[model samples]
Target: MYKETLSSGIIIVPMQQEHAEQLEALQRIVFPNLAEEELLHADQYKKHVELFPEGQFVALDGDKVIAATSSIRYHFNLNDNEHHTFFEIMGGGWFTTHEPNGEWLYGMDVSVHPDYRSKGIARALYRARQYTCKQLGLKGQMTVGMLNGYAAVSDQMNIDEYYKKVKNHELFDPTVSVQEKVGFEIVGLMKDYLNDPTCGNAGAVIVLDAGKAI
Candidate 1:
């Protein structure tokens, strides 16, 4: 497992391939609506293991992986409508080639073992992502789901408006909240993004400017 201490001197590290199953199980418990096919697939874990093993930071209370968080970076391609004057004034950009290497981090899969909850483990893992982003020279971070988003078919063929009624829909996952607390901001919403029956509503998209990294 990869490991390090935070500015507050807490130990944290990366989850190993061996811990992938546990992480998936934990994520399912926390985010039951997430599609099993997409979120818990073995290949998905393998990709993370290969591409972001170190980005998948875990907290160890001994030899066990107690909590975990990971990130994936890719180019964001912004559509024309997003180029409005107000959007640019507010720095509304992600789907574009502007970022050096055309990169943005998809922060995902944060989970804390029951015994480790309330111990600030999530905060540490989040700090680790920020640290990695800074070290890699990334420009920003993004996440899915915020408001009025509902699950639709893979192609968003049909969607339900019930998403506006889902409780806690605006609340960020622990990882997302950490990103926001450190200056990440909500950029846009992905309507009917995920069609999986498991995920309650479509996901929201959030962004954190690289300049805000601590």
Candidate 2:
């Protein structure tokens, strides 16, 4: 009833009743400082609940789920095409934007337990998710990432300086090269939009496309 695959000597599959605790623990460690509304807690499991049947995947060593990725399906209508579904967003859960529901999957909220870092678990999990998306006939996937606030301004708006004043750090700079290695395209930026108060400013929004796969 569930999809199964093996990676790096570990078993990867769709999460089931046995993985509730492991998933909860993973969320706590990966998302600790955010508020209730800002945070994605176990209570919100319903948002991703049904996806387990069609959109969730996990990487496990023995009985331990070390890495995970959740898939989201968004429906969108292409501007040029005649009411056709073209955009789908997916990622490791670090970000979420418009819901582009179509023949596509949005990869969201990816995490690797600290103890198991740098072990290729994440890469394996990502591939499995991609495989699932393709199997379901999704043409591609989309994702967004946090970036610096300086370049988020438009000449008409002239809000670049305000962006810097809001966020004091450049930690989320999307200009970095690492994000490129994973097949993403920089699309847009949101300035002082998040209002994190703590992080000081809003973050950048990058779009990644996973080209057609067979």
Candidate 3:
């Protein structure tokens, strides 16, 4: 039950079974574009807590969960050339790929309620993840970041071009931009990372060194 005060009334805590229902509802609200089969259920939450309790975290305003980040450890060879999709890396979305002796922490998802956007909740969750990685002595943290603002400009430029623009600060993507600000660097791009139409079926693989000076 680790807790971190975010503000006068907000805090972050390890996800517990008691937060299952709220977590499910919050996922639906945050990722409404995801297919029904893609959204997590209460039972899944229970499984997550059982598999790796320390890897899951939730942000709250008193008793209400406002944001969450799910993660799992995996044996990732940063030198490997084999490109893996989100489902493949996540073991078909069940996080069954988690390896206790894995070298890196793979962030499965981070969801913040729309109403709470730009409130520093997501940044706080990321800081917690970095702390977890360092404490576990893992190599680092990795995630496929969605390009939340891609759709609007995708037709005018290829994904690669857009990505370059983002890297050069000529473009801004709601999701990737925040990730960059948090110290994550784009490793590459992924296709079919998620079914969400907003991202144009692509995402950016971002990585951050857990032991890097903050």
lDDT of 3 by residue, 23-118 (tens): 999989998888766677778887888998878999998899999999999877656535776667766657788898887888989999888888
Query: Tens-digit lDDT track for model 1 on 84-134?
Result: 221221122121212234376666546677666676677676667777777
User: CA lDDT, every prediction?
Assistant: 0.53, 0.51, 0.83
Candidates sorted by lDDT, best first: 3, 1, 2
Model 3 / residue 2 / CA error / Å: 2.1
Q: What's the number of clashes in each of the models?
A: 15, 18, 0
Q: Which of the two candidates, 1 or 3, achieves a greater TM-score against the reference?
A: 3
State residue 5's C-alpha deviation in candidate 1, in Å. 3.7
Candidate 3: which stretches are off by over 4 Å? none
TM-score of each predicted structure versus truth: 0.64, 0.63, 0.94
